[model samples]
Each structure stands twice: as structure tokens, then as C-alpha cells.
Target chain A: MAELWELSAAALRAAIGRGEVSCHEVAQAHLDRCAALDPRVRAFVTLTPGTALAQADHWDAARARGEALPPLAGIPIALKDNFCTRGIRTTCSSKILGDWQPPYDATATRLVREAGCVLLGKTNLDEFAMGSSTENSGLFTTRNPWDLDRVPGGSSGGSAAAVAACMSPLATGSDTGGSIRQPAALCGVVGMKPTYGRVSRYGLVAFASSLDQIGPFARSVEDAALLLQALAVPDPLDSTSLPVEAPDYRAALTGDVRGLRIGVPREYFAEGVHETVRTAVRRALDLFCDLGATVEETSTPHAEYGLACYYIIAPAEASSNLARYDGVRYGIRADNARDVIGMFEETRDLGFGDEVKHRIMLGTYALSAGYYDAYYDKALRVRTLVKQDFERCWERYDVLVAPTSPEVAFRIGEKAGDPLAMKLSDICTIPVNMAGNCAISLPCGFQDGLPIGLQIIGKSLDEATVLRAAHAYEQAANWQPRVPSLSP
Target chain B: MPRLTLAEVEHVALLSRLRLTETEKQKLADDLNVILQQFDRLQAVDTREVPPTAHAMTLTNVFRADTARPSLPRAELLHGAPEARDEFFVVPRVVDTE
Candidate 1:
């Protein structure tokens, strides 16, 4: 029999529902796994054992009384530290908010809690989700479960690692630009970022208002769909939250891909992509072709401009959103400041990491009096061009397939000092966010002991089709994602 | 080629409400110039006829009833503040008392 911690979310939920396993037992197994494994992975920033046990016992008692349970009841999950979990300290992994507890829960947090998902812990991320590697975490870097020396691609690195290592069966992540998918690809799990405004961002600490989205990390496509179903409801808290009903994500995972149109964008296969990654994605496409899904090479000409447009727009929005962190409120305060201006400057300088500072500076320059039209405005227009490229593709194809990241995870400090190289790590994943569409990354192949991610993109608000294609691929490929301990 | 000078870097830092050391100014200027060269590529692409999109999804004013609703308790709201007294946030003086 499989250990409680090793069971898939669907299996565990059924076991708990059938009274074969108590929710308490399931929650305890995950907590014990975290206690044993977290010292090596550093995935969790804070573990909520008391709350998890209480919630588990609550579900167990309700089941004993023969009451109907909510979907995803009693499954242990990890929340990225950027989410505001009321009473749990939500550090966006920055020194400024190191111990500051949020007064309210992010809508996604509230919905998952309402669904009875046990809280395993809050996972680490890059400071304010600014970098591609977890090395940017002000608390500590979360290592790749596959290779401890390598990064679990970030800014949602800890969530990806936690799910990969069985620390949690499901975890939530936010993608500004490939924060979820890139890490999931590197860690050999499934990560999906829903269409923009698909998930409410009420209490979510914003990185880039236009590009940021909350998503899920699971080991299987079915599990990703289940978790997303719990999180995809519209909320009045976020005005940008889509007002329409969320399509039934889990029910749509029929795993039948007959006649599904899969488009392989040409630019995603161009130079700079590792041969192994390209080969893995192409093979995944071939597998789709065999499964009766048609595959064709298409062109999205503006994808190369995504990096430049993203850097400009994301930072500009980040600079504005992060301005609220000034010392007058809930964050760290600098001592020995003579005035409010000095206080603000000193506290921010002391609080933010180098990456955060760099972005803030870039944004400040771009939004300044003389440079707004040249930098911020130009990026916005180019952003339209990037979106139009995808719009054109959607007119012809139901889904676009590519390698989630150009390369697999790199060593922790390999690109830490070189900004450009680090930024390039997310080149393949950033374009989807630029267009405000939906994308999912799943393990397609392995290279030298590291797993490769194949990305499937869908039209805006069409996560159902994306999951269907990925589910078909996962079922046909018959690949069981490898746990770190099983790795060669 | 230097795109952003040290003085410009410092000015940008001031606008960002962050203070940088002399060494930081030097390093950030170099980093900013590197990043700016990429942004400059946008100049080559003609966007004269393109209208900017602030969001990916089409959104309109979301209206909820104007009825009064219970809010978070004042004490609880103030609890997360760095320093608070009598339900008010404490901060450095804003006025010139000299």
C-alpha cells in the first residue's frame, strides 16, 4: 500500500471519503514529510501544524456525522508566501514584511480554505516575486528537489518544489512571467496559470497587475484541474475578476484529443533553446500526432519582443504597487530617521533586495517625466503587438505547444550575478503572460536526470481545452513523474 | 555606451523613494543602461497607430450595491502596522515645525 503522503490528491480524497483513511492521518503524514524533508528543500517558510490538524479533525468529524464534504476536502496543500493568509505571516519573501501577518485572506486562499484543503505551510518565493531563481528569496533559497545544487525555477520555486518532493500534493502559485510553469517544468510537476482575472487577486500582493495570475501545482493534469476548479470562481473583491461563471475545469478533462488542433509556434523552436528541450517538446508533439491530434508549425512573430515588453510593463506596475510598502504602515521601519522622507528612503533601501531595487529603479526611470512616452508607453503598444500575434494564432489553432523553458534548471548561483542570463531563463514562458492567455506546463521528458517541461497554451479563458490536451498527452505518454529520492 | 549616468540613477532612486549608496549608484547605473538598451529596441517597432491595452481582458465598471457593510475591526486593522496608537498609524512628522 502506498504511504498516505505519496498518494495522489484524487486517491487520497477518495480514501478519506470512504473512511479507509482519516483526514487526521492524511494531514499528519504530510506534516511529518515536511518536517523531515524541508531542512533539505527549504520549501516552506512557515508550517501551520495546529491549523492543519484542526481543519483535518473538522473534516473527519463532519464525515463521521455523514455530512457532505466540499470538493478537495482535507487535502494538504501549500500556499505561496505572497498570498495573504489571515493571521499567517505572508511575507512576499522580503525582509520588509518578514513577520507582518496579513489582516485578511486572499480570495484564492479563502476559496481553498472554504473547500477544506488543509494548510501545510506558506512556501518561499523570490522577494516580491522579482527573480527567476529562488536565490532572490530574502529568507532563503528553495533548492530544486531533483538536484539540490540547482534552483527550482522561481518566483514560485518553493511551491513547485513542495509539490515535486511530496511535501504537499497540491500547492498554489502566482505567475507574473512563468513563475509557476517554469518551476513546474524544472521540478517535473504540473503547473498552470489561468487566464488573467480568472482568479481573484484581492489580497494577493501584486507584482504586475496586468500580467500576474494565481495558479496551481500538482503532479498530474487531473489534479491540476481539480485544484483549479476550487480557485477559478469570480470574486467581487477584484474588480478585474471575470464576471462570468467559471467553466467546469475538472469535468472538461475527458482526456480525448481526437481532432484537437495543436499548433507548434516556429519562434519557440528557434536558436538559444537547448537541443534536449526542443527534442522533448517535439517528441511530445509527435505523441499528440499519434493520439489523433493534428500538429502544425505556425508563426508568432512578436514572441521575441516579449522580454523587453515584460521588463518595462511589469516593473512599472511593480514600482507603483510596491510603493505602499513605505514604512508608515505594516512593513519594516528604519531607525534613526530624522524625517518621513529619510524614513521612507532608508527603510526601503534596507528592506528591498538588489533585484527588487533594480526593478524599482527601472520602473522609476521609465515612468519619470521625460521617459514615460519612450519607455512605458512604447512597451504598452508593443504589448498590443504581442497580444495580436497570439490572437492571430487562436483564429487558426485551438492550442499552441512549446517548451516551457528554453533550458532546464541551472545551478543556484550560476546566473545569480548575470541579470540577462537569468532573465533569459524565462523567455519561453513570458510571452503567454504578455498576451493574458492561459498556459500549463507538464513533464514531457528528462535530460541528464532533470525533467523537461512541455507548455500547452490556449486562448484566453479556455483553460479547459488546454487541460484536455495535456491530459490526453499525460495518459498516452503513461509517464509517472519521478520523485527526487527516485532520481538517478 | 553609457545610457543612464550616475546622476540620473540617483535621481531615479529618489523618485522611487529608495536611497542608494555611492557604490550602489555606480552599479545600478551600469545595470540600468544594460536593461535600457533592450527597451530601446521598442523604438524600432512602429506603434504609432497602435492603442495601448491596460488589461488583457475586457472589463467594465463592476457595481455592487451601495449598502453599508461590516468592515474589519479598527483594532484588527491596526494590528499589522509597524507602530500604532489609539487606532491610528504612528509615523514621522510630516509638517515643518522649525
Candidate 2:
């Protein structure tokens, strides 16, 4: 059973193609795994076994007719609840949107369906993708597959945990502030946040529009590249989607790390990082050095200010994006309202979680007339300094490598009381989003029996280089044995 | 560091349209105080000459041609609305008129 679950997505695709395993068998096997394990993990908000089997049947029929099938034929993938899927309840794990079934599919979701992938179901998330831990989710908090008590780092916690637990080979995740990579690091899986605008945000329920990017979560770097291939098409539906040539990222994984200049950000290691996590990052860097890569200590001087800028900018945008949920247009509505304002007041207060409401209020204040210059405007200026810091580093190195998070997965309720500590977890990560660069997090080593992730970030649209470095490191380390002690 | 007064927190909550009870307002004041103190660290950085950038890439003149496209059926637009009248979303008066 473990052997079957451990197969890479590429190998699984080959097997399904050769009739070695039928599409129905693949779908049923994953369903069975989810059924047996998901209760303990709580990774999925909704499991659509019926829809999955139907999609699998369509793939099987296409193959039987000897017709050309898509590249990802019959592969099971979990959809993050934030991505809008037509006819399916696309909740962002907020009670306000608990019943909203979007009539449109996000451009990325549509492209994935067109590629013949089976949509397993929508995974859980932090409400509005705001919190670092899934505890902020209105529905269920996703547990790290490695340890039931520990959190799968969130907003994309369920997506990372689903792939980590073998509930699915690949899943989609969106990262605004370490949503994808932090969770992937905690769950011992591969998660990529493509360069901003590389993937479409057309139907993704916006958290921070300027910062949010949709990407793939997978068991291996190559598998992530395959899913990235399926989702990277430019779409007119998203005005922010980049119109650059979509490169063949899968072919770029040459698995050779020789002469690649890897930058170790000096400020990232200065302090606040856990000793165990630092050791793991240092070991990964040493391995890169042994693999013929030149490791250099680089500095993103203004990185210390990232958390400040990200909080202001992300929440400000979130304040605007979430303004649509005034209760009259869609989803949950306050039935007992005496007036429109009452309806909005009652609906949002009851529907949004504490963290979501906190952000909304903070953002509204930040963007308010009196504070805009001091908070939001100044944060934007600091954001420019942070981006320039990265630009200077990119001119000297190929990619920047750092620990994805300062610490391993903490207990579920550990930092739930202190939101500042929660915000600090993304300190090393928020800069990438603010800089609008590409980054991938892959398992590097284990510390105290939990997995640690080494993050590789590249200049804008340098996902191929990031993937190559990660793939080479993953192959050399072969650290797949460190799957967290997660039981279904 | 910017200090958030209780009155300011109340005003912000009103702007965000969240009707907070007195107890909730007190709790938010405490939370917002800690968050705002963290922002004080940013004042230490010298960004005096740095130009603010909202986007990383240089994109310009992104306007699409002003050609009118087929519109969504007005009936369908109101299909998901909680309350609709005559193929339009029905709402209480937002701006009071004499």
C-alpha cells in the first residue's frame, strides 16, 4: 500500500496510460485512502467521490477510443477551496461563503480540467487565506500528516497535507504570504509559488490580489513542474496574468546543479530562526556546494521590514477584495436584517473569523485618510526597497536559498493566542511575495522528527531556474523517507 | 509608533462595517495596539528616496479596446442575489434622498 502511494506522479501517469491501472482504480484507490485517513487529518472540506469517478470515466473512455488524451490524464488532484469551480461549493473556508457555488471556473481550474486531471475535491484553508495556521479556518483545522497534534501550516494547509498524506498526488495552492510554501515545509511536500502573474488569478477568491498567486503542490519537484505546466497558460480573464511566453518548465529540470550560484541571505540567518531549522538549511547548502554549486552569503538589506510592509499591503488589498461579500450579492445573507446595512453588518460579523475581521479592520484603518501616509503608503515605499534588495542579489546570484519557516510545525493551539508570533512565522517568506518573485519549498531534512524545508527563490519568471536547483537538491538528498508520522 | 485610540478603533470598525460590541471593541484595541507597534520598526529603515512600487513588473497602457462585449443576461445576473426585483438586485436605499 505504501509502495503504491509512493509512486511519483510521472510514473503513475505512465502506468495509467499503459492500462497497468485503470482510471477508475486510480480514483477509487485515492478515495479509499482519503476515507481511511482524512478524518484524522481533516485536510478536505469537501470530498467529491462521485464527481471524481465521473471525470476518471471520461479519461478512460477517451483512451479506449485510441484518441489523444491530455498529459495529466487520470491523475487525481485536490482543489483548494479558494479556487472557484463551477457547480461546486467554492468556499474560502469562511462561513460567509460556506454555501456559495460559483457559476464560473477559475481559469487555472478550467485549464486543469481540460488537461484531463480528476478533481478530487476542495481542501480546507484559512479564512480569506489570512492566518499562518489552519486554526483560523472557519470549518476545520488541517492537521499535519506527520503529527496529528501539529498544524499543517495554512491557508493552503489542506492542499499540502493532502499531497503529503498521499490522499492525492498533486494539489493546487495559493500563496499570498507563505500560504503554500510554509504549509508545504511543515507537511514535507513540494510546493511552488510561481512568479507573480505566471499563473492566472481569474477565479481565485482574492485575499491580496497584487500578492496572491496560484501554483501546484506535489510530492516531487518534477510532479510540481507537470502541474505547473497545466496551470501556466495566460488567460484574458485575469487582467494581471502575464503575457510572456510560457516556457516548458518540465524540460528545464536538467538535474545539474554545477556552477549554479546559490545565495544564502545573510539577514535571514541573523536571528529569530530556530537552531534546528538553521542546521537543516546549512546542511542543504553544504550539499549544494558538494554538488558543484557556488554558495555565497548574500544580503537583502531591507528584509527586516518585509513583515511590516506585507501586513499593511496585504490586508489593505484584502480589505478591498473582500468588500464584495456585503451579503446581498452572494453566499450567506442575514435573513433577519431590517435594512441593507444591518444585513451586511450581521452577515460579515457572523461569517468572518476573528483573524479575518481583525485584518479587515486593520486594513481599513491603514488605508484610511489619516493613517494612509504613515502606514499603507510608507509600507509601499519600504516594499520597493525590499524588491530592490532582491534585484541587487539577483544580479550577483542565480537563486536565494533560505529556510522556508523559522521553526517546524508547532502544536495546533501553541500560537493561536498571539497573532504577532503568527505573523512573524512568515517573516522570511513575505518578502518573496512582496518582491513578486518565484519560490519553491521542498523537504530538505528532519529536525526533532519533523521535516524542515529549504526555500529557493528566483527573480521574476525564473521558476525554471528555481525548479532546476530544487530538483537537483532533492535528487541528491533523496529525503523522501522523512514523511511526517501522519496516520489517516 | 502610531497609537490606536479606542475611538479610532471604533471608527475603523464602522468603516469596515463590523458592528462590534463594547467588549469586542476593547479586545480589538488591544490587538491593534500590538500590531501597530510592530510597524514602528519600519520607521527605522531609511526609505527616504525609495519610490513606491505597487507592482514588480513594468506594465503600461493595459487598457483593452473599448468595444462593448455581449453582456450577461440581466436575469442571470440577479439569479444569485438574495433579493431581486424586476431583474435587478434589490437593496435598501444606500444614500438617503429627500
Candidate 3:
């Protein structure tokens, strides 16, 4: 019998269809794994064990009764706490929301539930997905599965850590900048950030709503693609969600990369990138070239401006999005207040973390009356150039390639004091979000025993190409077999 | 480069609605100064004629249908409130006499 957790979603569905393994047994095995590993890692905030088991039993009975099931039948998936799960405490990893239980599921969460994905639990995140290291999680910092002391890259760190540790085969992650990809890279798992608006953000707590996107973190490119397929339905509740037919993302993996034009931005190879990361990226590129794809050098002139522009825009949007969390509406409220403003101040002051406050303040400054033209408006203009640069390249190349992060995962608290260094860590991934394109971070290779990711970026709604290219590279490199030995 | 004073840091924090401790205020002032020094570097670029972009690459007007929708039910929506009277969440009033 196939070990339940080791089987891919495709294989699991097949086994369930063939009656080799019942959905209940598979889910139970995953739950058992979660029980075994989650305590040390602190990957989850809530595990609805009964709900997951009941859902699996429902699927199992349906299968036993000759009922046709959905594509993701019996697949166990975890959700980032930011994606509200009805009746589950969706804290977004902040004390403000510590006791808040969302009454309605986010659009994507509901869709995943309807697809028969067993909800294992809600994973931890950076308070409001603001920080890079899961260390910023207000509840508990999730440790990297590869090395316990190290961080699993944040906001989506818990999701990445859980998937990497085999606590769950798949999990939902939201990326604004590199939240999904960076952590996935650090954790040695597959993280996909679909083109902005490709997945519904209806249920996702607002974090720079313009750039925030829902994607997947999984053990493999194919598994990530499967999660995307299930989650990509256009949600009407999210006005920004694009109305388009979801692609057969898994099927797109069949085609070869022959004649495909892959561009390596000349600027990406320059200053500040670590040597090992560059080497891993080059090796991945070499693998693509060996697969008959043509590798060419290109430049996005405004790429260097991505970080500065992102800092302004993301914080500005975040400030606006987070303004909803006033003392009254939702989340924690101060016990006693002399006045409404005092209550607001007390609630928010106690609720948000330092980084969150810093961004909100910076954003508020940028959008302030005198500074709007000099900052936010100027950043928007720079944003135009960056997008144009991507368009020009895509017109010539099928996809763009680069190292997902500048370096391998730094130890937890390494850059905590130096916010600028932490901000620069997201340099490469930020531009993709700015341009609203899709990107994937796959385990290219490792640096000093820690994994590095090679990024494959695609045009908008072009998740198939992103997945295809990453899948091809994953297969060519066979990085799947090199899963970190976590049993020790 | 703009040097942020302790008072300026306090003002910014006030605008940000954060109640910073004395140490936090001191630390943020220094950090903000360094951050501003970096922002000053961007001034070298002659963006006099450049238009700032908020959304860089993809198509705009990624829209959904404009239709009336029912509001969230009163009770369920406000379930997490720490203090509430009737359907409304109660808080101290914002505008007040000092």
C-alpha cells in the first residue's frame, strides 16, 4: 500500500478512485503526521481534526457508494490564518484578531472546501503577513523544517514549513511581494504566486490588497499546480479578481521547453546576490538550456527601482487596507476608553506589531498631502516603467528567470534589527508583484545545506507556463528526491 | 537627507496611532533617520518628467460585475466585538473636548 502522505494529489485521487486507499485512511495518516510534527514546528493555529476526518469520511462513503467526486477529492490542505475559515479563529497572527472567529469563509477557502479538500488547519503567518521571517508571527515562530533553529520564510512560513515537513501535502499561501515564494524557497518546497487577481482575494484579510494574491505552497510543482487549479476560480466578491477560464495547469506540464525563450535579466546577475544562490540559478538555467530552450540575456531597466517603489506602494495600500481594523468593527478592543479616538489608539497600539506600525506610518507619510506627489505618485510612475519592462521582455521571451531570493534563508532574527537588509531580501520577488505577473519559486539547489530557489516568472494569468517551466526544471534536476532529512 | 527629530518621530507615531514607549520612540527616530537617508538616494534620479506607477505590468480594469449585494448579517458580522450595544460596536467618541 502506498504510504498516504507520500502520494501526490493526483496519485491519491487515483488510488481513491481505484479503491486501493480510502480517503479516510489517507486523511487520517496525514493527521497523524501533523500530530507527530506540528508541536515542535508550531505550523498551525487551529487543526479541525474532527472536521477533516468527517470530510474524509464523507468522501470515502461517496466513493464506496459509486458517487463521482471532484478533482481534489480527499486531498488534505492547510490554510494560512489570513484566509478566514468560518468558525475558526482567523487571527492573521495578531492579538487584535486573537479571538476573532470569522463567520464566513473567504471565497477561495469556500471553493477549496467545496472541492473536497480536507481542511487540516489554519497555519501561522507574520502578523498581517508583514514580515519575512515567520519569527514575526505574534503567536509562535515556525521553525524551518530543514534546520529547526532557522526560520521558515514568512508570512507563509507556517504553510511552507508544514508542507516541507510533510505535515500536509499542500497549503494555501498569499503572496504580496515574496511572501509565498521566499518562504517556500527557504523551506525547500514549491511556492507559486499566481498572477495578481488570478485567485480570489475575497476571504483573504487585506494586506496591501493591490498586490496580495492567493497561491499555493506544496511539495512539488505538480502538487502546487493542482492546488492552483482548485483555487483559481474567479470570485465575484473580489472586484479585482480577473474573470477568466481556469487553465488545465497540470496538463500544461506535458509540453517540452524546446524553442522556448527564457530571458535572464542582466541586472539580476549584478551586485548583492550571494554566490551560491547565483550558482544554483545558473544550474537551473543550464538545465533549461539542456532541455532545448534558448537562454538569452535581457534587462528590465527599472528593475532596480522595484524595491523602492514596492516600499511606497505596498505600505500605502497596506495602510489603507488595515485601516478597517479600528477598535469597533472587528478584532480586539481596548477594555475601557475615555473616548472613541482613545479606544482606537489603545486597540491598534496594542494590536499591531512594530513592523506593521512602521509601514502604516511610512505609508501614511507617503500619501500625506504634501508628500503624495513626491512619494506615492512618483512610485506609481516608476511602477509603470517596471511593468513596461516586463511586457517588452515577454514579447521576446516566453518567460523570465532569476534567483527567487538574493540569498539562502538567513537564521531567524539575523536581519531583524536591520530592516533595510530585510527589505532588500525581497528585491527580486517584489518586481513581479509590482508588475502583476505570476512567478514560482522552486528548489533549484542548496547553499550551505539550505535550499535556494530559482524563479520562473510568466505573463499575467500565465500560471501554466510558470508551472510548466518549474515542473520541467524540477524533473530535470530531480530535486524532489532530495527532501531534507527531518526525521532526526 | 532629512534628519528626524525625537519630536518628529513622536508626531509620525501619533499620526500612525501608535503609542510608542520612550525607548521605542528613541529607536524609531534613529531608524527613521537612516531610512530617510536611503530615500534621499532616490533623489539623484531625474524623475522630473517621469510618471509614477502604482501598478506596473498587468492590464488594468480587472473588474467584476457591479451589482447590488446584501450586506453581512448584523449579528454574525460583529461576532468578535469586545464590546457592543445592539448591532453597533461601541467605542469612546473621537471628537472630544480636552
Which of 2 and 3 is the better model by DockQ?
2
Per-residue accuracy of model 3 over A337-411 as CA lDDT, tens digit each:
687767777888889888888888778777877777777877777787788899999889989999888988788
Candidate 1, residue A318: the lDDT equals 94
**CAPRI accuracy category, model 1:** high
The model with the greatest DockQ is 1
lDDT of 1 by residue, A26-136 (tens): 999999999988999999999999999999999999998999999889999999999999999889999998599888899999999999899999999999999888899
Greater TM-score among 2 and 3 belongs to 2
Give the interface RMSD values of the models in order.
1.0, 1.6, 2.2
Quote each prediction's TM-score: 0.98, 0.97, 0.96
Q: List the residue pairs that clash in candidate 1.
A: none
> Compared with the true structure, what per-residue lDDT tens digits does model 3 show for residues B2-52?
466788777777776777889988887776566666665456566777665
Which runs of model 1 end up more than 4 angstroms from their true locations?
A486-488
Which DockQ values do the candidates obtain, in the order shown?
0.82, 0.64, 0.57
Candidate 1: what is its chain A TM-score? 0.99
Q: Can you give the lDDT of residue A211 in candidate 2?
A: 93
Arrange candidates, best lDDT first.
1, 2, 3
Ranking by DockQ: 1, 2, 3
Q: List the per-model TM-score of the A chain.
A: 0.99, 0.98, 0.98
